[model samples]
Target chain A: MSEILERIWEYRQISRVELVELTGLTSGTITNLTHDLIQLGILRENEAISGNVGRRRVMLGFDPRFYRIIGLDIGRTSFEIIVMDLNGTILQSIEREMNGVQGPEAYFQVITPTLTTVKQEIEAAGEKILGLGVGIPGPIHYESGSLLAPPNFPGWKGYPLKQMLEQQFDLVTLIEDDARTSAMAERWYGLGKSVQNLVSITMGTGIGGGVVTNGKIVRGTNGLCGQVGHMTIVLDGKMCDCGNRGCWETVGSIPGILSRWSQGSTLMELQTAIRQGEPEALRCIDETLAYLEAALVNVQNLYDPELILLGGRLFPLLAEHLDQLKPRLQSRLYAFAKDRLRIEPATFGTSQSAVGAAALMLGFLLSEPVRLLSLQDS
Target chain B: MSEILERIWEYRQISRVELVELTGLTSGTITNLTHDLIQLGILRENEAISGNVGRRRVMLGFDPRFYRIIGLDIGRTSFEIIVMDLNGTILQSIEREMNGVQGPEAYFQVITPTLTTVKQEIEAAGEKILGLGVGIPGPIHYESGSLLAPPNFPGWKGYPLKQMLEQQFDLVTLIEDDARTSAMAERWYGLGKSVQNLVSITMGTGIGGGVVTNGKIVRGTNGLCGQVGHMTIVLDGKMCDCGNRGCWETVGSIPGILSRWSQGSTLMELQTAIRQGEPEALRCIDETLAYLEAALVNVQNLYDPELILLGGRLFPLLAEHLDQLKPRLQSRLYAFAKDRLRIEPATFGTSQSAVGAAALMLGFLLSEPVRLLSLQDS
Candidate 1:
């Protein structure tokens, strides 16, 4: 039954016959499940427009207006909160900058008001609120739903973010790594819709990564599987905030790139310098590109992902130079791996992580429909 | 039904009551399934020892003597073949030196005669050969069952090894990466039996690794997920045979270690030197340990495996120094990850990959029982 709902969600509007073929479920089983879902108000049926002058078939899809999910993305420098429908369309959104907000107490002061406003907006719309989903930087203790030594946010380490959110809002809350949340967003509504094996790279002030294999996130034993930023690029070269030296982020991140480009204070400035063909900027970009090429090759060899989605603030600036990186990557990759590997820019812009956070809740709801059903009953 | 068989295989012997509790299958279903399995000669029933003051319960277990598996492990300098029963007990074994053997035709000359003898012996013993399992040295194009530009064996690239074996033996053939095969062997009858998330690293003339996540092998898009050996440890530090510079194997592999040691030409000699407290050997070992420490940290950060099983010829020599390596690893790992990360030596000795190859066929047969049943029918 959940599979049926998932297929409907994926297709937007799927027919009973198509569901039967796709799921390999019996026609009778599909009809019964769809009927129950429709009766429960989770799905709705619509008549398909016919051009053949024959019987029009009915399509089944999610009743997108029925439920809403609150998504929050907490970065080192900023936070964004949003309310979204089942189709992942943002209904309301609010963004704020964090000027060195240090601890949980300071974070709550800024977060509480924004969440309250969004919650009221969602409630006033005559829609149900399913849950709260959060995307936080760094590795998380999945069992405890807490942060684990997030770089540059030492005060946030070990904070029970999920518990705090649930207690404040009295709603079910799910916390995930920000990069993984972005990958989830891609899996649902972006380039990852059809790809099962993929790695989403967040190239920003710091480099981070998320992996999806066999259609599920690769959350390792401690939920630390996607720390691609810390992968060593130059042995004993540069000290990183993570206590490791020569981490890939030390050479490929925005700050890392800006450090080498004497004329740029920001990625935008670096882009401008490169556009003007400044020798210093070109040299810096080339050095960064070489490291990026090596890291991408390592990603291919280690994860063998079918597609690598590049996101975050810095990716677009480097988008034009991707052609230069590809041939280098192809030459280094295994022969069988070279032809199938794909590198592409991500779909969403600034809202990628926030929408992905909402997707975290929506994805859970789709997989375990009974939870939503119980919430509705309550 | 496959789940029931897997549980029985894991437990070695169990009663229907335990099967019901373990598998969550109804008592009636357990009885029917076990009865059918026994009837097919896939399982056998035995009376339990009467330690209690009650009637003895009948236990069900595999009829090991009825079936057999052939395992082959191919390396750059050597190859090994073994025949085993369902219980993983080696019945016959053969080992030979490759002596710079290259290309498919040359390999067939040596492999064919040995396989023919093994096949005749199994036939004479009235044992059914289930399949032929081959464990090759490098990444394979899984879909096509061929090697893809394996380093040092350029002539063997693109060879249809699986098809060639299947045609010659008239038996089911399975091919897997050598490291992964070693992991499979562990998963079935060794330390990995109790571990769900584990990585097995083969530190030999060349380094290799295999990952098992969520209790199954992580075969990425092209069956190249666990190329831990090629992960860069130093940027432009040393040239690697795989066309990469500063790969972990360039520092941590046996040859890589020997290149830095002036007094030793072989690993055994190096081990002897280190044991004798020679300063040069100690320095070389320390250097190798630092690189290994970095590589292991990277593996932990990227894969976050619960346990890392270290195998191959060189690991045992370094086993005594693991105490020295652990503290360094602990300091660099994430706090939540530190306590849970276990580094241990592999269970099998020299025949790890060969036995692992046999277990591959056994694993496939267990998952798809119908295939074995169909073969029985034929």
Candidate 2:
């Protein structure tokens, strides 16, 4: 039954026969499952006329308006909140500058009202919000949904973000690392829709990565699996704030790129400088691209992901320069075999984090429809 | 049914009540499955008297003599072959020196007669040989079971090893990269048995790795996952033969350690020097260890495996120095959390490769018991 729903959710408008072909389920089982789902209001069928003769075939799709999910992307510089329907279509999205947001108390102060506002607005239409999913920076204690001491987020250690949000919102809350959420979101709705095994590298103020294998997120033994940014790239080259020297993020992140020119310069300024073809800016970008290329190659060798996604703030800037970057990455690959990497910029931009956060709920809902039913019952 | 068999295999000996608790299957289902398996000679129930010895409880176990698998480990300097029962108990084991063996033809010359001799000895016992699992050192086209060009093994590129073995032996053949097989062996029958999520590193003539996630081997999109040796450790430090600069294998492998002192010196000679506290030898080992420490840390950050198994020849040599090496690795880890790494030497020693190869067949058999039924039918 969950398989049929997943097929419907993935296809958006799949027929019973299509589900049968896709799932290898007997037509009788499809008929029964779809009937039950339709009756439950989770799925709906519509008649579509084909050709001038108007031959109608029934198509199944998720009842988007029946359920909604809230996605919150909490970043160091800014935060984004989005309400998405079951189909992952954003019904409402708002981004706010969070430069001055200090501690968990300050974060709660800002987010509480925003949550109330979004919930009220959605409730006004009599739509149901099943859950909230949040993307937080740093290592997450996934089992407990607590934020670890993210280097950038100074005061957010051991904070039970999920528990706090769940108590306030009276709904199921799922929290994950921002990079992993981004990867999940991409896998479901963005550039990585078709690929099952892939790595999503978010290169921004700091580098973070997420991996998806066998169509599921590769959460490690401690939810610290995708911390590729901290991997040593240059031995004893530069001391990183994470108490390591020559970390990948130190040389490959947006700040890492900016550090090559002026440490204090904003990414916008760096982008403008590169756009003007400033030699210093170009050299900095090239050097950073080299590090990025090397890291991607390392990721490829380690995971052999089908695709490597470049995400976060720096990717839009690097998009134009990707042609220059691709050859440098390919040149470093293992010589015996033909390279099978498909490197691409993420389909979504800055708002990707928010969408991905929302995808956490959607991923759960898609994967565990029985749990969704229990939640609906509760 | 397969789940029950896997749990039984994993536990070695388990009671029916334990299987019920572990599998969460209904007692009736467990009873039915176990009865079927026992009737098919896949499982055996032995009466064991405990406590007062009046009551006898039937404990389930694999009928070791019911099935047999052959394991072949083809390496650069030597090769090993072993025939083992389903319990991974070696019935017959042989190791051969291949100082001048060149190409697949030469490999066949050495292996063919040995295989025939082993087969006759096993068949004389009136047992069935299920399949052959061969582990060759190189990148492999896992689907075709063909060995790719390995730097150590010349003239082995695109060799149809699995086909050749299958046609010659008249048995099913499974071939995998040596490192991956070693990992599989460790996971099933060695130190890694308890942990599902782990990475096995083979650091000998060349470095290679295998990852097990969610209790299954992580074969990448092209089965090129765990080629950690090829990943660049140094940025433009030393040009590698694989057309890359400063690969992990180039700087951290056995040859890499030797090259730091005198390239011609054998590991045996280096061991002697290190024991005598020779400064040059100590420095070489220390330098190579530092590089190794960085790479392992990188692996941990990337894969977040529960344990990292150090295999191949050099690890046993490095075992005594592990206490010295552990701190260096731990210091570089993420600062927020206490590092939870369990690095250990592989249990099976030099013959681990052959054992791991046999595990490849066991893994397949364990995973797909229904397939075994089809094979039996055939």
Candidate 3:
């Protein structure tokens, strides 16, 4: 019963016969499990079929009123929170702007009040929080339960986020890099659901990535696995926050885009011109694509993942240069070898980071017994 | 008794009292298993009292005469074959060279006489050849039972190596990449036994790595997972045999080392001077270390394995660089990660590849139930 519910949690709906086939169980067992799930009010049967078969098959799916997970996206000047059902269906959410957070005391003042306010809003809407998952833009120490280094948000390193949330809310708490969390969101509810080994390339103000290998996010020895943003792309490109020169981010990040366009116009000015279809704005987007092609080619030649998802606020510009990157990658691949490559746009858009955090909690707490057993050992 | 034999395989021997402490089985059960193993001629009791707590003790170990496995390392120019017992003690071995092998069929023709001669030598020396394992320089397709693009063996791609060997000898046969086989040998009989997620970097005319993750060799979808040799190190640098440019092999290979040396002096002249500790030879070695440092650092950064083993023929010239590589790697890794980093020399040297292949075959055909289990889908 739990396995079928979990599978539905992954997707919208699946038929009883399909469930039996997937689990390789007897029809009687499937009937019993589905009966128990429906009785618990966690699921309902949809009496609709879009195809011709032996009979009109009913699809079993989540009821949406069973439970909810609170996803928090902590940021420097803004915060976004979403209330999502166990089925990953977001019901009500809010985004707020923050002036500043100086230290732990300031963080406590901001977080406690915001969380209390959100909880009251949810209670008013007749929903309860199952757990809390937060996505911060930085490297987080999973073991010590502290923030390590967040380049975008200063004065936030090594904070006791897990404890702070645990004290205020009686729920499971998790804090991770925003990129990894967003990648998780894509894996569970987006294009990466079928991909086992994938690289979620998040390009925004500060570029980064989340690496998933063997069906789990690879946490580096220092929680730094997907710091490919810091990996040197050009020998002497530009200065980066990691005290390195020629980092990929220096060439592919939003700041990099602005830097390339700074010769004639800034992003603020380019956006105005791009809206009018100016040649200078078009040239800036094109050159950024060329630089991205070189960096992406290196990643492609190394990991060879099944999919590469483009997300964040900046992906709309990707279509401008994707046509050029494809042929460059194909030209470099082995001859006679079939390359199973795919590139997709993130469906969640800017809200991906928050949803990803929610998915992480769901995946961690609601995984099947077999997967839960292995997660503990790993 | 099987537990006792496994312990002996690790620490050579343990008294009956120690066996009880290790296995945690009842004294009566231990007595029965030990007696059964002795009757089966797989174990022998040594009448000695070397390792005892208070009372006299009898040590138990493998009966070396029980069986043997024949291992062959077939390189581009030479071949080294050995007959070693299950205890990993070599009985008789032979090394020979063959300059040319036109193709797989012609390659077999050149090695046939040597194979027949070695078979007779094993039986005459009273060592039964229980199985045969061969390590070649190539990508082996385990599912297809063929050699996939063997780097050094030209015209041998997609050849059914395991099937051909099995048809000839009527014994269990296994074939693996030389580097990966060496990694297996290291993981089983050398430095990587107690370690998980260790990599064996084979440095020679080319640089390749075998990644052992979560206690298994991660053979990517097409049996081409650890192509570290082809990892792009320099963008738009030298071309590699795999039809790619700027590969790590282009800069870190033996020919690269010699060419880097030849800029100032001939490689032979530098080798003679290195014997005399000349400054020019030392400088060339330093340059070679720099190239190696880039490759090893990137690999360590990516996987964060417990240890990195440097093997292959060129390691003798490259061993001194470990001191330089360790600090660079450590500075980039986590502080709490104890025993998670180290650089070790391959104790088995060139013979490890062949021994590893034998271990591979033994791992599949041995009495261990899980290894010997038929892979038929249930």
Candidate 4:
């Protein structure tokens, strides 16, 4: 039932024949399933448009007033929260700069105001909140509900995100790596909807990626997958905090870009120069994409996501340079990957992580749990 | 009907209550469904086993006499054939070496003799063959039904794989990369049955990987997934024929080991020395593992499959050194992955690819036709 409903939601709206064609389900099965779904308050009969005089067949769609999931984007400097309805509709969202974060406790200390406002807004609108999802920039012990320290975020180690979210509301909570959440946002509501496999490359002060395989996030063993920034894309390039050298992040991070700017000029100067089509600045960013290409090739050689999305605050600049950058990537990858790979700029921009976190909560509710007797003992 | 039968086969045997409990379906639903499944001739009620003596119950099992799939393991110098029943039970299998594979016509010459022998063997056993599946060592153009220029098997590029098979038998024919096929085989009858996401790493003449993400094989846009061998692991360590320097295969493949050994001594001499506990030869293999460690880190950071299966003809040596090698991987990867990641040897040994190809064919027939359109197109 949920699978059929999901197909409808994914397609936004679907005709009866198309549903059978897409899902490979019998027409009778589709009819029976959709009937039950509509009666359950999950779906509605979407009215036909008044375009041409033809057989006016009504389409099926999710009711916009259905359950909503909360999306949380927790970063070192700030946080953003969003409420997304089940039909991919946004209800209420808030973004704010963080308070003084000293230790892991302060991580929760700051979100109190944002959380209160979001819940109040939803309740005022007379809607039931399904769940809260928090996206953090770190390696989470998916089993233990603990966050490990990520090099990019200095003081966010060991944050009890799941407990705090669950305590705040009588709802199931899910926590995901911020970059993965960003990737998910791209996949669920952005350009990734059409792709079965995609790599969402998030380039901020640090570099990260999320793997979408068969239209699902490729969470690795222990739930730490798609950390492409940490891969050794450059050989002996620079010393990275992750105890490795030539990491893509080491060569192509915000700090690395700023430092290079400082060596001769400044980012502002480079920005101004690039605005006027400066050859040197274009060369530098193009070179950065070369490392980006290597990391992406390593990613391609592994899972082979059909699309590659470039996200983060740097996207505006990255977009301008992509026209120049893509050709380099084309020449570097294998013949098969080069021919099939599609590169696109991120659609959600800075808010992807927040939106993706909410999707995780919804996904958690829909997922079937696995039982590990030994793990339960532990 | 088949889904319920699959559940019965998976559990080996289960009571009505157990089925209800496992499936979370209502008792009435289970009873009705079981009756329908039983009527379908896909399931059977075998003799009962009384665990509690007085509380003996009928044991339901998959009907072993339903149908079968034929699998072919197309290798560089040999071929392995396997006949698997619909319920993933291998009825008969055989392996034979090709004396001479001169050119692209090798498939026509070598395959004829092997198929004739395999047909007689299965006919003698009185079984119904459903389809034929073949696992190629390199890329195959599923649409063209021709082999790609595989690096290892130089003589068999563009061979008409599907047309020849279809001529001899009235059976479904499926084709796949050997690693991908081997990964599917594990998903059906081996270690991957319990895991949703997995990476099967085959370390032999070359290092290859098969990605199982979201409980399905991740065939890339061009069906060239799991090409971990081509990924560069070291910085200019050794040149690869694919025009890349220091590919994972360059440092971790058997030919790579031989190349490194040739610089000091022959691989035979090194193996003999290892048997005699010679320090220098031991150090060389240890260095090879170090290079492998880099590739392992590369694999982990990219997708993070739950379990990493080490397979192929030469993986027995890897098993002996896993205890030592696993620690290096642990120390390098993120804390959560280090504990959650499992490394195991291939269960099917030398015949995994053959078994996997057969499994692919069987799964296609058992599943809804629409899902396997790409497979059917070949």
lDDT per residue (tens digit) for residues A1-378 in model 3: 456766676557888888888878788998887787676555788876566675667998876785577899876556788888867888767777676556556765776787788777777877656668898877777876788667766778778788877777756678888888888888888877777777787887787788777667776555666666665556545756654456667877777777766445445565666667777677777667656665565555445567777787667666555777787765655543335667777768888888988878777755653343233234
Measured by TM-score, the strongest candidate is 2
Off by over 4 Å in 1: A50-54, A259-265, A275-281, A375-378, B49-55, B262-264, B276-280, B376-378
Interface RMSD measured for model 2: 1.8
Task: For residues A1-378, write the lDDT of model 4, one tens digit per residue.
Answer: 556766775788888888889889999998987786566445688867645776577898876685567898887667898888877677777787764555556766767766877777777887766667888886787775668767767666776767766677645677888888877787777887777778888887788888787777877665667888887765546767765566778777777666655435555566777677667776777666666656666666666668888888666666766777677666656665477888887777788899889878656533421111112123
lDDT of 1 by residue, A58-160 (tens): 9998877677888999987789998887777888888899877878789889999888877877778777788888999978888888888888775898899
State interface RMSD in Å for all models.
1.4, 1.8, 3.4, 2.4
Clashing pairs in 4: A197-A305, A197-A306, A220-B304
Number of the top DockQ candidate: 2
True contacts kept of 4: 0.43
**Span of 10 residues, lowest total lDDT, candidate 3 chain A:** A369-378
* CAPRI-style grade of the A/B interface in model 1: medium
Docking quality band of candidate 4, CAPRI definitions: acceptable
DockQ-wise, the better of 1 and 2 is 2
Give the clashing pairs for model 1: none
Instruction: Give the clashing residue pairs of candidate 2, or none.
Output: none
lDDT of 1 by residue, B262-285 (tens): 986998899999999999999999
Candidate 4 residue lDDT tens string, B80-143: 8887776787878877776466564665576777677777666677765667888887677889
- Minimum summed lDDT over a 10-residue window in model 2 chain A is located at A330-339
Per-residue error for B42 in candidate 1, Å, reads 2.1
TM-scores computed on chain B for all candidates: 0.95, 0.94, 0.83, 0.86
